[model samples]
Target: MGIQHVGEIAVWASARDGNADAFAELFDLHRDRVFRHALRLVRSQHDAEDITAAAFLELWRRRDAVRVVEDSVIAWLLVTTNNVARNVSRSRSRHQALIDRLPRGMYQGEGAFDAVDAHIDAEHRETTMRGALAQLSIADQNVITLCVVEELGAAEAAAALGIPIGTVKSRLSRAKARLARLAGDARAAVSTTGGAL
Candidate 1:
């Protein structure tokens, strides 16, 4: 093993032994990577930040169960990020449904209306990407996030996901095709609607 691997093992061991400073060091070392992975999975900066925080919180909560792979806790963080993103997405969907059920006139103030419009416009692309990802199976989404978005090799992704390399390859292929089709359909919809809504 390299020097960095040895260092990581030491850090992980310290953190596992309830060393708060060591755990914070681990967080500082990996926060950006975890945040970026969360961003890709969730597609909203704010939500990604939330997911990143939640992932770390989960890491602390599950410290006893933490499984380090290849001398790093990143694999565990990525998996936790995925799970947190799913929960956040589900909660957002439920909240939106509740909002939609509210009487329209209840939200009809001019400031509220303008704010809603601006928020929707700002989130259009994120919404589109999220929709595209939603079209994929959870397994496919996980593969795409690990292999494509995070640029992990097939072997590494398989290790992270506990799947066979062949399965990662096949799932990535299908996920890519599905994302392409979804993008095409989104573009067609935009053109059909003359870029409105």
Candidate 2:
């Protein structure tokens, strides 16, 4: 076996035996990819780091169950990253709703909105795309994250999501439609505000 395979086998054995060092080694090897996956889903560096750490914590806690599979640790990381990212999204959505419901002038500051505005323009259109994606259903969000953001094929996304490939295609189609509507709305809002100014 090559170095990676040998390392994976060793880590698997040590993890099965509940060795922290082995788990740490596994974490070190997978952390960057895991963080990137989390970043792609969560869309915030801080949240992504937190999610990645939480995922690794769960993996460490469930070390015995984390064996060397065909995709090795990367697949496990993706699964964990997805779950944690959804949790983070839910929390943020709830918090934002509460903030939105607050009386105007109760909370003061355009700082956050200003920051978002700064990221606008064609060069940062990906940020706009991500914002539009946030308006999608949770299921659609998962499908888009796996298939589009993560660049997994429909069949692979279906396997990851425990659904049929057809289902993945259907969800992605709806997600794209919803994303387009949301993007249009965002653009309209920006245009109206600019006209007012």
Clashes of each: 0, 0
Native-referenced Cα lDDT, model 2? 0.73
Q: In model 1, where is the ten-residue run with the lowest total lDDT? A: 1-10
Worst 10 residues of 2 by lDDT: 116-125
Per-residue lDDT tens digits for candidate 1, residues 70-163, read: 7778877887887888889889889879878998776557588667656765656666676788677778878887788778789888887888
Off by over 4 Å in 1: 1-6, 107-127
How big is the positional error of residue 140 in model 1, measured in Å on the Cα after superposition? Answer: 1.4
- Per-residue error at 159 for model 1, in Å? 1.1
Tens digit of lDDT per residue, candidate 2, span 2-51?
32757676665776588777777777788998898777665568888999
Per-prediction TM-score to the true structure, in the order listed: 0.84, 0.68
